[model samples]
Target: MSLVDFSSDAFIVAFFLYCFGFLFYGVAIIGRKFSNRNPDEHMHKWGRIAFITSVLGFIAHLTFFFTRWAGGGHIPTSNMYEFMTFLAMMVMLAFIVVYAIYRKPMLGFFTLPLTVIIVAFAAVFPQEVQPLIPPLQSIWLKVHVTTAALGEAFFAVGFAAGLMYLLRVVDFNSKEKSMRIQQRWVEFTLYVVVIIIAFIGSVFAFRGMGYEAHFIQETVEISSQGVESTTTDDVKYSMPPIVKPYNSQVQSMDSFLGMKEPLFETPSWMKGVDAARKLNTIVWSIINGTILYGLIRLVLRRRIGAAIHSVMDGVDPEDLDEISYRAIAIGYPIFTLGALIFAMIWAYIAWSRFWGWDPKEVWALITWLYYTAYLHLRLSRGWHGKKSAWIAVIGFVVVMFTLIGVNLVLVGLHSYAGV
Candidate 1:
């Protein structure tokens, strides 16, 4: 096979290896009770095996990265698919570093699943290598994207540990108002995770079934000279449309589950062809996520968080909190250098400005400031355990919005990064 084709195959291998690594970690944790050997010995043996598998997966992922870079004539991080995969790989690297330090089997149980989810999410975007745009052609693209993603990977590890901290300490049996509030918020977080998984699953399912729809969207633009210009573009959907683009007509739409057309038109205020598609995707994700979450609830007859909390029984909340804090502390400076410093340097080169209030730039600043506050509160306010864990979790949410949400919802210099 060509190197590019080989790289694709290697990526598939890496993905399966990561999935197996997750399953093995699950076995290391959950199968201890079933084993005839001493529980500690069983967990130690299986955790070692799981860690080895994860290391092999990381190697394969690295092979994919370098091979694709060689074959595609650019670093494999110029698009959403490439960047997410690189982020997943860096998460694995960060996990390896932390796991080596702690030797905690439960960390693998949480981190591997996270790595798997991220890899799967990366697959949702187009994978074909494309030439970088003019703005992305500089050496700073490699420097900025890789370093920023590496820093975010540490944050992702912190998120896993923080989530584990919650599952470890939160009382599922408590009837107190405060505990109930905590339970609800934890459940909501799990629901959001399930929504992401559901969205990925739904995308792949419809893709496998070859579902598609098409539309012609007319965009009206006004020039500085007050000249009105109209442009029409073709928009395609891989899933059935629940909402058609505003002020656009259907070119052709395949019937789906007895539905022949969109149920509604996108609100006029939501401009761009992508806006309607993105809103439609959100609607589908929510619908499918609710159904999937309902099925899980039916099976367990308990909240998903409670179910997970049961497995967290022997894990220490204090250690998890410490790991979360350490991971974020390590990442914070790297993020400052990459997402802020290198970014401004590149912005100076590309846009001839050190700072501009672009939506992406604004959100990047928001994320940085939020994390800065996180560190401040953590150091000065003595926020430990649950408070620290919650901040870590919420901080990752802010990071994700800066990375993904800005691209999807707002148009700016970073719009090209969105799929």
Candidate 2:
């Protein structure tokens, strides 16, 4: 196989192995009653075995990551596919590091599933490698993004810890909080998320079946006389666009939604029509995610979180709370150095301006400030337990918005990160 092909095959194997390892971890935690003399000893021993499995998976994954780098002739952080995959790897690396320090199997239980989510997310984007664009032709691309991803991965661990801490400490069974996180709303939101995933899945699935939304789009092409003229270009939405912009015209309208323009046009500045075109993909993913979630709920007949919560009875709330704080303390500075300082230098080199207030740059700052507030509120104002945990959780949300949201929702110099 070509290095890239080998890398792809190895990545699939490693991905499945990670899933299997997570299942093993689940068994370690809750399966002790079924087949063990001493529950505690069995849990510990099985947890170690699960960790070993994860380690093996990580090695395979890391090997694939590097092989991709070698095949691509640069680090794999320039596109959504590469960045998402690399981000998952970084999260796994952070989990392994924290697990080594604390030997907390609970951490893996919390963090590993995120990689699965990330893998699903990465699969949504195109994987074909393109030549590096001018803005990304810098050594700083590797340095800035890698370090920033590592920093965010550490913060992601804090997010997992904070979530666990909240689950353990918060009385979700309480009437008021339960009412606030109303079952209907929660279910609805989950449905939306899952439907989105499913919609995206359908796109990939149908594309494999040679399905596409055949459409005609107007384009400007420079002629041999160096004069630009408007021309009609035939386009296809591989994922089956659910809707196109109001102005878009399709010559051969099919049953597929993309063959016709949407009734509404998206109001966007930079991305414009491209932004409108993307709505279908997003909408489809939400609907897709919702359907898949419903099927899962049907099978389990219990809220998945609550079911997972039952297995985590052995988790210590205080430990999770403390570790969450410690993780932020470690990650914040690293994030600043990479996402800010190094990023500025790269920006200066690429854009001839250190601070253009690009959406990505602004969100990175927002993330930094959010975490800073988290630390300040925690250490100075004596915030701890539930409050601090919530901050950590929100801080990571801001971090994600910076990484994923900015790439999707806005257009800027960091366009390379978008697929």
| Predicted structure with the largest lDDT when compared to the true one | 1
**Which residue pairs of candidate 1 clash?**
none
Local accuracy of candidate 1 as per-residue lDDT tens digits, 1-419: 88999999999999999899989999989898789989889999999999999999999999999999999999998878988899999999999999998899999898998899889989999999998899898999888888888889899999999999998899999999999999999899999999999999999999999998999988888999999999998989888999999878899999998999999999988987688888989999999999999999999999999998888778878899999999999888988889999999999999999999999899988988988998899999988999999998998899888888998788999988886
lDDT of all predictions, in order shown?
0.91, 0.77
lDDT tens digits by residue: candidate 2, 1-419: 77888888878877887888788888877787676478788889889988998888888889889998889788878899989889988888888888887887777777877777777678778887778999899998888998899899899999889877766665435568564474344345345446645765776786677755555665555789999987665555655556664345655534554445344443433244456556767766766676688679789887655555566776788899888887888788888889999999999999899999899999998888888888888889999987888788777778877888788778887766886
Give the distance in Å from residue 365's predicted Cα in candidate 2 to where it truly belongs: 0.8
- Window of ten residues with lowest summed lDDT in model 1: 308-317
Provide the lDDT at 232 for model 1.
96
- What total of clashing residue pairs does each candidate reach? 0, 21
Q: Estimate each model's TM-score.
A: 0.97, 0.87
